[model samples]
Target: MPFKKLHTNILERLERKDITTPTPFQSRSIPVIKSGANVFCAAPKDSGKTTTLILTTLHKLKCEAVGNAPRAVVLVENKEKALELYQAFLTYTKYNSLRVYVGYEELHIDIQKSEIFEGVDILISTPKTMNKLFLLNGVSTSQLKIFSIDDAGFLIQKSDSSAIISITQSIQKCQYVLYSEELHPKLKRFESYFMEHSKIIQI
Candidate 1:
């Protein structure tokens, strides 16, 4: 079953998808997230890390009634990965009022307009696209409370450290979650920046 701590509505939605038991990562990280702590986790792909990310993020938004303007920003490696995460996010928040925007390069420059960001509670994007959004969107991330990097190893490999820091530094007093399929030496600097004194979960 989904953890008793999770929202009932989410459990019902998961039930519709035949998702009952929590994966080890899901179980271990959910409570840590519930406590609003920073997390650096390593788990294999398709090990339900995305599900945990969705659940924790959705639950937090649902509980706190945070105002719009993309309170949570999840950084993936590319447009394809952003779309994939957006799909899963939609599946989990289907019954909720949350809005998710995918910031890919293919999208027209019109996104710089404020109308494009209306009611947007979560943002899924690449590091480059995120940087551009910050420059052009005129959107305020002051209310953002969750910053997630889905493929930290890959991001480090691409030398996206500066772009990542720029976004994280803009937000204050938010929870951070970093997950990677494999850990590399390059990821150490990324870990230290956000997960300082935070818990580490390895699977």
Candidate 2:
């Protein structure tokens, strides 16, 4: 896998951080992702999908330096899941100059009280929060490089029709990666929508 062959910078970063071996999901998906293809990965929990996405997003961000308009990489997941992912990304990219933010159910409350997502490069959010932010014009999707959905099937099943529509409408040109444990029938419909040229890899 060409993509699995980490770049010199990324490999050096991993080595400095004591991350030598790639996980199963990373070994399989990284190569395909680096090939610049849309990917849909189905694997069990704790299979390293999150780490793969974080690393890939970092690689993309580094390759295409953020423009003046603040390019962002978005991850949409559940509220409970957001915290874990946020912490993981923070730990993984500690040495990198990446800015991470968490947008979940009550992000508005924080925004109303104080500034929340200023200078955020990576956003981990839920569907509802993302829909609200899209509606309020708080975040711009135009500069997004990576649009990821972790536990995508679960999120789609839990999301309202309008929310789903809003999120899909906001992100048009992003390279998408959808991860889930099981592929639901409902999520398959999105293949024709957001993901046209997609590869489904079961781990």
Candidate 3:
């Protein structure tokens, strides 16, 4: 019944996609995420981790567009993952009012700023790009609600972890969720930065 806890629009989309029966990971993690806690979701591939990310994000936003600033931010490893996740989100958001925007280094900061200023509900980007956006005041965190990192094993790098820490420092308060195939030690270190008192869901 985790899917039932989602927004009506999201539930409708899930039904349309014939996505009933939650994977063990989704069944366990979705409710914890819905509770608005910082979570580290560890699961193997094809266990519906990404779907849980998309579903909980939509549920948090109430499946609708709001202010110009993004309420949800999703961080990925690089441009390819950013674009792939963007497409995946689109399949769920296409019939709803929520607006999803993707950003990476290839796109000019000015263009991203202008488009985001116009309006966006969920903002997806690489850690470096997101740090740059925060530094330049390209996006507002005043309304931010949730910040999730997808396939976060990449954070093992010094540069990427540095960027992520910088971004978290700028945000006042928000839920942070990290999804990965395994719980890397480096990721656990994030408890000091933004994952304070975090919950872990392993499947």
**Best candidate per TM-score, number?**
3
**Most lDDT-accurate candidate:** 3
Candidate 3 per-residue lDDT, tens place, 1-203, comes to 79877888998998999988898998999999999999999999999988999999999999899978999999999999999999999999999899999999999999999999999999999999999988999999999999999999999999999999999998899999999999998999999889999999998
Clashes of 3: 0
Clashing pairs in 1: none
Cα error of candidate 1 at position 174, Å:
1.1
- What's the C-alpha lDDT at position 14 in model 3? 88
Error of 2 at 53 (Å): 1.1
Higher-ranked by TM-score: 1 or 2: 1
In model 2, where do residues sit more than 4 Å from their true spots? 1-4, 7-9, 63-70, 109-117, 156-162
For model 2, how does the per-residue alpha-carbon lDDT over 26-92 read when each residue is reduced to its tens digit?
A: 7888887767678888889888887788778778777333433335545555677888888877775
TM-score of decoy 2: 0.85
Ranking by lDDT: 3, 1, 2
Clash count, one per candidate = 0, 2, 0
lDDT of candidate 3 at residue 176, scale 0 to 100: 96
Computed on alpha carbons, the lDDT of every model, listed in order, comes to 0.77, 0.70, 0.95
TM for every model, in the order presented, reads 0.90, 0.85, 0.99
Determine the C-alpha RMSD for candidate 1 after optimal superposition of all C-alphas.
2.0
